[model samples]
Target: MEVQYRSQFPVCSFRLTFAVCVCVRACARAQVCAGAECWSVHSNHTSQPSVCGHDDDAFKYCAYTITYMLLFPIAILSNTGALVVFFWKCWHRSSAFSVVMMNLALSDACFSLTLPLRLAYYFNRGIWYFPDWLCRACVYGFYLNLYTSIFFLTVLSMLRWVAVMQPLRPQVEPVRMARVCVGVWLFVGVASVPFLLNGVTQR
Candidate 1:
């Protein structure tokens, strides 16, 4: 009886181990199925599992299309509207208000011009097909415009404060406003000189 029991113990243990393995496999399959269903319901955009360091052209295009289409239209419409308003106000009644508005509009327009190149860059994964000088110049010009816009806004606020507080004093005249705008632009250009010297082929 002892010999018979010892012989049968190994068979019993093997059967128990097999049963546990089967149960675990079944549970794993069920969990996988449940996860897939949950994700399917939650996500509208379907994508393959990402492979690390893989340059997926399809995913790149999907992202690029969404970003470019949305941003380009908004930039165009908003900047164009601003430009029209600036021109209208400046032509009829040029003041510190008009100067700041015009400067802001110019900055937006200048920044808008770079969107195409930026969109192109996304499509090509940071590759630059445009001229090196032009790209650097664009970057330089964008920053210059931004800083100039900020400077004008600050100046505009100061002028408005002075005019409101001291009504007897003369307001910011057109000639003086023009001079300040020109000075801002000139300083911006000089500040951006480093970009022109650096060129565009920055890695």
Candidate 2:
């Protein structure tokens, strides 16, 4: 009876080990199947609707298109006409006021030239296919013009105030005004250096 019991113990141990291995394999297969199903469902459901997405929808369709298209030609023509008049008719005046006005016109014209590229970007739904350097230059020129325009406008106002208040004072020398303009250009150029560097590194 003891020999028969000992023989039966070995069979029981083998059966228990086999059942555990089968259960582990079954659980692993079940987990794999579940993971595959979950991945498939997630892939089907999760996707971006569009590249640009909904944030820019209003601007892309309404504001950007309308404003850029409308203003492009108007800005270009007006600024160009101003510049032509300045260079052709008023170039010989040599007044500080005229010099500042010319710089203002030139800045406006440069800003206007960048508008067409911006218009094209808007037309393409904010996609930039141009060379990176050109895009950087456009952006740099835009900002430079913006700040310089503000600066020059402020100077012009100051000059106007002086002219009105101190009516008897002598006018600002052309050489001094030229030096001021050069300083402004240098300052704006230096300020824009960081922007150019950032553009080169970023996308």
Candidate 3:
């Protein structure tokens, strides 16, 4: 009777193990089928190109393309004209106001130069095909110009305020105004280094 009981125990254990293996395989197949179905549905539903997990819809692409196209030429021509006029008429002036205006025009012109790259990026639907270094340089120039413009504009406003309030203060020396412009440019350049480096390093 004991021998018979031991034999039956082995059979029961074997049956239990077989049942678990079968159940696991069945569950795995079901999961595979479900995953395949979900993937098929997702692929079918999404037709637009994606960038960084976000869909680049046609409307968004068109909007940016139109905006960049319109702004690119306008910015380049106007800023170029302004810079030309500033150098032609105001470059020899030594007043703080003139210095600020010159720097502002310079900054705007530099920013405008980067707009063609931006236009190309948007035209390509947000994909950057340019060399990584060029892209970084363009981006750095854009940001540097932006901050420099802001800084110089603020300084210009303050200078105007002082001129209006004092009404009789001696004119700012050309050398001093030149130093201020240099300092502002240096500050902007130093501040932009990290951003430029990070952009270059990123994937």
Return the TM-score for each candidate structure.
Answer: 0.62, 0.68, 0.67
Clashes of 1: 0
lDDT of candidate 3 over 78-132, digit per residue (tens): 6667666656655565456666677777787777678778778877877888889
How much lDDT does each candidate structure score?
0.63, 0.66, 0.65
19-97 in candidate 2: lDDT tens per residue?
5445545554555434232332345687444332133354344455556676667777777777776566355666777
Task: Please give, for residues 142-164, the per-residue lDDT of candidate 1 as tens digits.
Answer: 67766876786687667667766
* Model 3 lDDT, residue 75, Cα: 68
What pairs collide in candidate 3? none
RMSD of 1: 26.8
Name the Cα RMSD for model 3. Answer: 28.5
Worst 10 residues of 2 by lDDT: 5-14
108 in model 2: Cα distance from truth in Å? 0.8
